[model samples]
Target: MIGVIKALYRTQLLSIKGIWYLFCSIRLVGMNLMALLYVRQKLCPRQIAISENGISINYCTLYTQSEHLAAQLAIHCDIKPQQKIAIMAGNHNILVHALFALARLGADIYLLNTELSATQLRDINNNVHFDWIIHDPEITWLPPINNLPTYHENQISVYALLTALPLTHQMKIEITHFAKITVLTSGTTGRFKLARRSGQAQNFVSPFFQLLVKLNLSHYRKIYIATPIYHGFGMATLCMSVLLGATMFLTRRFEAPKACQLIAHNKIEVVTLVPLMLDRMLTYSETRLQSLRCIISGGAPITATLVKQVLDRLGRVLFNLYGTSEAGICMIASPDDLAVYPTTIGKPLKGLCTKLVAKESAANMRNELYIKCAWSTGGHYWVATGDLADKDADGYYYLNGRVDDMIVSGGENVYPFELQQCLSMHPKVKDTAVIGVDDEEFGQRLVAFIVLASDAEQTEAIIFSWLKTMVARYQMPKKVIFVDELPMTEIGKVDRKKLRQLLS
Candidate 1:
């Protein structure tokens, strides 16, 4: 098996020649580390940047890069020491360098998501000027960007950092008045949570990519980030990659077949994926995914079947981590955990705390999972989360569902999330969600709403068999209703309440 794996890997590597021409444009990016790298080591403020070639970030290099960025600011945007700017692009190496330069120059940074519609952008722009809007040139439909003043950067958002870079010691500003950063929460729950960190706030937690590089997990020179950078998961991956000194391979658009080629050719490591994306990759390839050291899974829950399929088909490098924008990484399921309990989301990360709170009441032990951490962000721009959960005697927290989606069925509790996760595993079920319907016999009945793959109808018997084996009798959906798509919020989380209302 090992020999076969090696032979197959060789075949995949050779196929990269077909795609090498695509990465030729990477030369357009230049490094300009001047004086910005210098910082108090006690603060540990200097975040590291790594490349597939090797990490070239040193004190002198970082310093030079900072100085060069400061020079760019004077040459480009006339920035005042006290002024703040917002960066509206996904993760780019230039963006990270820009953040470092911004900190050195005392300019505020606001991280904005690219998915916001024009009306939504208008509301956000009202809060602040986003003085500079640097984005993947591919995001062409930005009506909000057209509303902002012109910036000097091209394609990448590096210019945002350059505009804020020039004010080193030239213009003095108070420490309290340095750049502030806002990370919009990935609304896993019903509502959005906005987290605001002060210009000098140390609340931002560094991601784990640096630790992975220091440990030499793999020889991946390029970090493949196909997800949206504005999301917390994508931002964390990008931040960690730059700090680890990896060249970020970004896709203006994500396509599964093309993503496969990048992974094999660039020696990409640490590819962050959402469950749906993973499903696409599994559908695209039948053989082992080549050259990937750690395919980190997060963003949403993956069913046990999907987990098993990825592990068996791809190599043993699947690292599953429990996530929330609010609490950081709560738990990590390593390769060993996948071998034992393929479905488990793993144990909590060092600083986070995990608990499962009952959905109905305190005595109701069978509830979804809830977690608390010192790092648990208080609120997203002061918006709180309404996720329901439960905790066990051993501290293993299992998710019940969203508190808002709770269905009281014949005095029994129903969590739409758990049912949805289970139903999504069916081969015929491209996507599935459970919603409560007003029933006369059982206060509420579980109803499954599905959008099948290829529009090919699947057998209810097979789905019933799978559900009977995976869930309890009462936990199962009473009726399976096929749909074109499940209701979703602006941030991409399933809207159970909306689905329930639709069914009603």
Candidate 2:
């Protein structure tokens, strides 16, 4: 009994030490990021920093072009301290710069999606109170007349407004000056949960970039961005790029072949993607990514097959960035980690704390992941991460997909992503989605929706062989339906709910 108790005590002590070490590491990364940003501000100052017109900003332009543009926009904003200003737009260089300028001016921002309908916009506006609306002329106008702004974006888009707007060095950064941004967690559907994060909460991205730099991610003089600017990943990435002195190429939406060509032609070194976008890029082998060094996948789980294909074809430059807008940036899979742990999401970001809790239900046991931030959005919303992960005995983390996405079959727990990754390995398979279907016997049965390559024709045996090799027997899908393409959400992810309805 004494031996067992002593061993348990030693184990508990080790766990505590690991957490402290992790926290210290994150503090160091944040410090490096802060120092680097200060350095760039001092030495790499430019009114309009850019790489080429192939990009909006080119090598000869100023590093602070977006900053200058924001200064001008701030004049129109008439923004005062403690006021909230909402920014909704497709990805644009000006939007990113404008946001920082807004922060500098001590105004809170509501980063919103432009895709919501006029009625939907009005509904959101009712819930999220904003003092001013600064957004794209096109999207802002899309809202219904009722949702129409008390202020207008079109007036500025016309004539020499860019010059006539506002230009003043009047931004002061104080804790009180930083207002919380209210972002809707669910995409315009169910009751909106506002993820209100302050400037201190939002500041983690700078350290994330610094950590990546330390990890030896190839720096991009010019980056091509395609995600909607209002979304967290898009908003977060654009903000972080500013500190790196990188020129940004912002697109309205994801365009597969064109995006590929842009990366090849523009020599875009760094880019962000979800799994769906990664699938599209991999399907067409036309793009030569010689200069591309980093591809950060977030917002969803990316499969091993996709990672392997990218590494095999593009010479191994894939990264996994794990975080939510509410949590700021947390864990990331470095390029080197991908080489060794083909399945893990790398290690925690320096200073970020992660733990594996026994997932408890009324009846079953599973692993629930808890990520505690060292500098997590430090107010109103500071709970541990809700996602679940299975930590190996060796301390690597394996994402078990989202808690809501898990399914039970024949008394065994099966993760949807575990099945999807298996089906995707088939040569005939182009992409795949797995969802749970009601079964009178088992409560839920696994069903797969697959997109096959246009050139290849295959039988069930071949597909099953692919699945059988990668996943365990019970995890194998009970049924498979091949489709021309999987249904996608507006934000570019597989719509599993829609798939379940169709199957039902």
Candidate 3:
């Protein structure tokens, strides 16, 4: 707790001037009754809030535009409180402004992924029953729906609409409650499920403070968010940027060279990305990332090889975050923790209760990880993570695999993640994914899909010879297939379903 206070002080949020601006920013969102009593002041009028595509937007302009957009939405689009609205777009200034405007209207906002297919979108819309859709010009291929109002970047310019509206001292509007936002799951396995975060500020106190102290985010003045804003990891970064008044860097689409250029030119201090994005950036020169103080990797399973590689190339700046969409962020592995055990996911965050539940009454068996935290979806009750894990003597936790992903081969239990981790340690293997396939003698056999290093040449026999010493006989893969690259999900997880399709 003392460390949290120190971090906040370092960010200047504890000072008198900072307090005033913080209060004003909250008031601008219309989240409190005290806002009505306090004197009106612009929220960080001169401070730059967001930078995207070589353009910068200050706080005053952001807030004012949000106000104007809110009024226009209410009058022209018939947007009202409790109305369900969907925003399907990438990270941009308009996206930020639209979020603020919708919050001011006290609407229920659903964040849709840009990678979602049209059929998936239709399925989601049927369940959510959205009142309106605000999307970018790139997403112009929306399915036709009767009587549905949609706003597109190419069809309607938000700034132009706001400018066309009449200017008044104040709009006749009062926000009685804060907006409710629904974030979708990664949908890696199947259909996406809706996950709602607690809107109360008190609910965020535990994890929020823990991140500030552990990541030292308060000390960073510039941050580059390389993940999608619709995801929990990226959304948290967006909110933190506002709270600390740090300059945020965003891009509609992620490109390795472009991202490297931006980070190098801007001298970005903090970077939030997935492991795949980090790997792609590493393909460029390491000097481009020398300006970074902290690099946060989440939204996917990070291998031990990647951890060691990051430490060797980037010093002690890498942090691995292990979490789920429903559970939110629960564990953080710092550089020191990774140095000790590259495979460990470190310890649980403060105010979280974590336990392992076994599938059977057998001893020395890996168990499913369950967590109970204030910020998670369920209240007070333990949320099943569906991940099989075990803890070391020193209390560091390591994931074995998913409970459903465990395969029974020759009446023996085998976890694919274990084999995949071992394969990833090989010098010739760049990346790999292991899956269970049907077998005649054994109930199921493991098949390894590997992507070799660009400069290395290896055969299945050589890989098998190397793996003989590393893994047990039952754990060995029955077949090894080399590929140029493995299919990946939007959030950077290996697409096992697609890998299984290749077997067919």
Using Cα atoms with residue i matched to residue i, what is each candidate's TM-score against the true structure?
0.67, 0.75, 0.89
Q: Predictions ranked by TM-score, top down?
A: 3, 2, 1
Candidate 1 lDDT by residue in tens digits, 303-344: 677777777876687877666766556677777676776656
- Top candidate on TM-score is 3
lDDT of 1: 0.56
Q: Ten residues in a row with the worst lDDT in model 3?
A: 32-41
Query: Which of the two candidates, 2 or 3, achieves a greater lDDT against the reference?
Result: 3
Best by lDDT: 3
* Ordered list by lDDT, greatest first: 3, 2, 1
What is candidate 3's lDDT per residue for 228-277, written digit by digit as tens?
A: 78787877788877776688899977777899999999999999998878
Candidate with more favorable, higher lDDT: 1 or 2 = 2
- C-alpha-based local distance difference test score of model 3: 0.78
